[model samples]
Target: MGCCVSLFSRKPRLEKDHWQHTQNRRSSSAKGASALSGGGGSSGFTEFTLAELKAATNNFSSDNIVSESGEKAPNVVYEGRLQNRRWIAVKKFTKMAWPDPKQFAEEANEVGKLRHKRLANLIGYCCDGDERLLVAEFMPNETLAKHLFHWENQTPEWAMRLRVAFYIAEALDYCSNEGRPLYHDLNAYRVLFDENGDPRLSCFGLMKNSRDGKSYSTNLAYTPPEYLRNGRVTPESVAFSFGTVLLDLLSGKHIPPSHALDMIRGKNILLLMDSHLEGNFLIEEATVVLGLASQCLQYEPRERPKTKDLVSTLAPLQNKPDVPSHVMLGIPKQEETPPTPQHPLSPMGDACSRMDLTAIHQILVMTHYKDDEGTNELSFQEWTQQMRDMLDARKRGDLAFRDKDFKSAIDCYSQFIDVGTMISPTVHARRSLCYLMCDQPDAALRDAMQAQCVYPDWSTAFYMQAVALAKLDMHKDAADMLNEATVLEEKKQRGGKGP
Candidate 1:
């Protein structure tokens, strides 16, 4: 059975403006636009600015690195929270990987058109100057490699393994039907489990990493024979890679295809099974999967089974449809921790400390820009056309924020900030809360930091930071920030001077 909920249940309906190139850059080709505009509307694609990404990932800090190769990998993957507060996997490619920015954008936009529950969908991309990055939905529950080979608690159950095999087959078949059949480096590492523990095929494999078409990144022994000959990947090459994955699931070890084929021929099926399983798996089912793997491993490309055939063969093997994947995989279901009680304070402080974003929004709307009055003290003579325009943008942002139109508020606030004519801690804090309401804690945190920079002793700035940090799951930091905000508020009430 499929996972309990659709992965796209919260998919963002991004604005058309977000897909446009920045004013400084030349327009992309019509083909790129056409491909991005597919699927009726811009429901699944976004073009992120490099600054937004840097803020999300804390400037690509090594602590956020998630790739198996870590920082040593030419292409590094970092876990980040978008301004919308959505967790994402950002794959930053090497500068030389895609020299032609247009080509990279077009390829990414094409891949972004595809949306499947069994696949970790590509949500956005960045092509700023010489930088190339692809953003995908993050899978919280580790990769198949970790679960299969280096599992800490227990090896994956046979039924779950069968489910993983079937789910990934469906993912590949879906991609094939959608006109994307060539998957690069299809391996256990590319198979990731979502929050529900259901396996998803990584969309990163659909795009060639290098312009030279160097597809496989793993050891040469695991690569398809044809790719060795021509340095190219066809639809059949993907099938060959799938065979290796099946071998991985069956044996729980990275066995060479040639060695696996020899063992199969010798009827050493029992010997090939993962000893960790302790013969718990169904022999009949294992035999059927083994047969399919051998067919996929056939030396001749034409001899390998199609993706559809793999799906059909694995469909009957599913035995546990009612049970959730997490239960079978021994992964704990994600549960929200209860809030810790604290001594009460003023309504705004209490709301901020508790992360009651709606309550905070109400307070912000009521207060309006009154806190900003003294900060932006512009003389009549100094009020230039540019200054008026910037103030007008802030006014527009405030109106939208009051109306609960967060996306419009963000856009207006961004315009106001870009003008750089005046500094308003209130504006930054309000925009920061708007970002929090929109589920983008990272952007909220950055805005909160900007507010702190503008008004170091402001309690609202620290409170907003606390809320953002709490949203990002940094509870310890959030508590510390909240405490600091409380101290700042108490000092302000007592008529104490700024620190």
Candidate 2:
């Protein structure tokens, strides 16, 4: 992000809708704060008071620890209140119980930043310095991993399983290039559910930011071979993890402890899926998902599509009206296919066309999204080649792009076209600020022109243009640019009509 007078980095983040507290929510920890300075969020992080967390988790009692379902490892949870005075569950994190410190922080960061309609919110954090604990908004319901694999005693509608799968994919997209959530750890039991039967991701034990700055993906079972071999996790590796989760989602079963061994033997993938699905969903969609999964789970990370592309592939299903689980599995439904597609995104292969666009767009926004500092995955990648290169570079040095070195800075900005475009708008808009501070209107106006040309649709660009032109004493051009921008916005709102 370039230095701008506005202080707001236009990172295209999902705001108030996701992080803004729903009510006067209060946590045992006072987790929801009105404001905190220098922290990442807009007003900084809102922590759940320990009091609210304890109440939400029933005083963090052992009885709340539900027995682990199926062959999955055990999990314990507690319900508590939040700052809003609402109830939420808190998942306790054991000290270095899973991964490394850096790895652990990355996980929490991803969970902290991930915000989806279907995904839960990360309200606060607790770390005794060395030990870390993660607290989410808490969904009354458990996890899909639980209802499907652990609690076979219960019957999850087949339609619901697919819906769960779809929502999870959206979650992945949110955490992936679309939402640019750096946090995504696909360990077996991380995803949670709410009373509304919606799913939220839990367990940031291994998530990492996808931005070039941090640690990446985890999960040895789902990790791509390319990543593991060379220490690089590509979007392909994530696809592989999605495939592994899909198998569980479809089969409605957990990965039997022994199954990991069987996976090594190449047992039929379908056999691993939750037996509950019983081949009930659309074979075409299933095939695509599974096939994509297979590609993702491939020993090679290059074989899979980025999650953004994958979501585009799955968007079409949103159009299909909700059908009974039986109907989904060819059981029967009065209304199956809707008259038209319900989702606004392209249904079919549109994702492939825009994969790069989505990926870059997502990456750009991540720098500005608010998240917990302890869990910031700004620099964790399992084994991506490029990621490794970046990490190696970081270990070797620090931010050499200081503004003092004008030529070096410009060169640095130029090669990073996408990031440059994003920063240029801010730098350009603050042209006057630059001139006032450094007496460098020449440099300021140059950047302003570039920013305006690069992101013209963005209002900041026009305003910056005004500053630059006015500084150059070309007041007419400056005014004309602002007026032109106004017309563009008005025309856009009126569907291309303006006086």
Candidate 3:
């Protein structure tokens, strides 16, 4: 037997056979549990539950939709936070996009195995019933398209643009080396900025957006010539798409490949450069990139350079290696702000009055919704299915709150509120803080108002409102609310009912 055969057995078992066996085992186990455990190189990959995902995205609310095309896209990507406080981008596929759940899970697992600093790595996936979703590390700053094409404040600097090209090329090369050469719709949108504003290739592009194999969603002008004829994606096709992205970086607009080639042919390189750069870019670097773009956009796929070649050609052009991407790109550096000093008050009152989110979060975690214990007052006769569900949701929210899982707490508390059973000001107050901790001051404000509606004289309600207002930058309103809360607390302590 050749190297392909197993040495221990006369019966031949190829490498593909071994892989298939492992995949079968994984698939079988996945069917038994709500999620598949990580195996092989995919140790970090998780098979998330539908309930967990629904809770993360607030039941796939449109408000959480983060896709470039928004709700109009067949597959919508939502920004979400897991119970562990990790932020994720959830791509929810349309119904029956992957009819075979096994295929979906396998594809997800294969893609999840790839992790690199250059990639927005796949974290997990959910294949519950007819719903199919892929979760990846959230890229906070936005896509290259947003910065390049629809820039509001300032366009990306030359150094930042070069960094994007070099980084994405390295990403493509890394993926190709790892045996995942084909990337669907490799465009500017597929390049996203992480917290540090570094460009990372979205792993979502590795898997076909749907099982139907309709890969390219961009305009036909930007698509590779081979794909138009053969209706399939190949490694060369991805290279051609990368060429279009390079043109986007150079021209600062979507220029068709054919049109851009004519400009390159006519020695209009200067005109092709982004006018926003104002001749700041080095001539030698621009010419090198233009030459590469011309070669990549060649009509014959065989004439185009490989992913590694692209990386080699672009690597030396990077001049700002020491500078952080956020600094080069003009994005504010993400840093923790020191808490401001505040006057001393009751523990809970002081935390909220100071608008110290960390202190308030700690208070909520310690309180464990004790104040809401007797507030609902559900009797045995009134304990129907809806009431049980409402209470169960509140119980779940309390547990999550105690664990400091604010996202889950928000979801469970929202469920309880939606049930519209017996109201509890404490539940609203707790959820208000959950929203605050989650950085949703508007939602926190709404919940605080709801708490005030339930119990107008509740000091916690006023305090939460104050905190939310302070977060929203309405400092005057926040100070007034804080003073009102102090008065209410004093009245309640002095054996007088608060107004």
Best by lDDT: 1
Clashes of 2: 70
- What ranking of all candidate models by TM-score puts the best one first? 3, 1, 2
Write one digit per residue (lDDT tens) for candidate 1, span 455-495: 55667887898788788755534654565566556656777
Identify the runs in model 3 with alpha carbons over 4 angstroms from their true place. 1-43, 69-71, 336-499
Model 3 accuracy (lDDT, Cα): 0.76
User: Model 1, stretches more than 4 Å misplaced?
Assistant: 1-43, 69-72, 335-499
List the candidate 2 regions with Cα displacement exceeding 4 Å: 1-44, 48-59, 66-77, 83-85, 95-113, 128-131, 152-154, 178-184, 203-234, 255-279, 318-499
Candidate 3 clash pair list: none
By TM-score, who's the top model here?
Answer: 3
lDDT of all predictions: 0.77, 0.44, 0.76
TM-score, structure 3 vs. true: 0.61
- lDDT (tens digit, per residue) of candidate 3 on 1-499: 0011112111122123433443443333233322211111111345677877788889999899886643255688989865544567899999899999888987887787665668887867888889999988788999999999888888999989999999999999989997999999998889999878889999999999799768987888999988999999999999899999999999999899999999999999998999998888999999999999999999999999999999999999999899999988889866523222233468877887667878887776676555444343445666678766877888888889888899999999889776654566677888998888889886787778666544445668778977887787544346545655665566567674422
Compare candidates 1 and 2 on TM-score and give the better one. 1
Cα distance off (Å), candidate 1, residue 235: 0.5
TM-score for each candidate, following the candidate numbering: 0.61, 0.48, 0.61
lDDT of 2 by residue, 363-435 (tens): 2234221211112223233335543453333222213222233344343344432331123343333332334
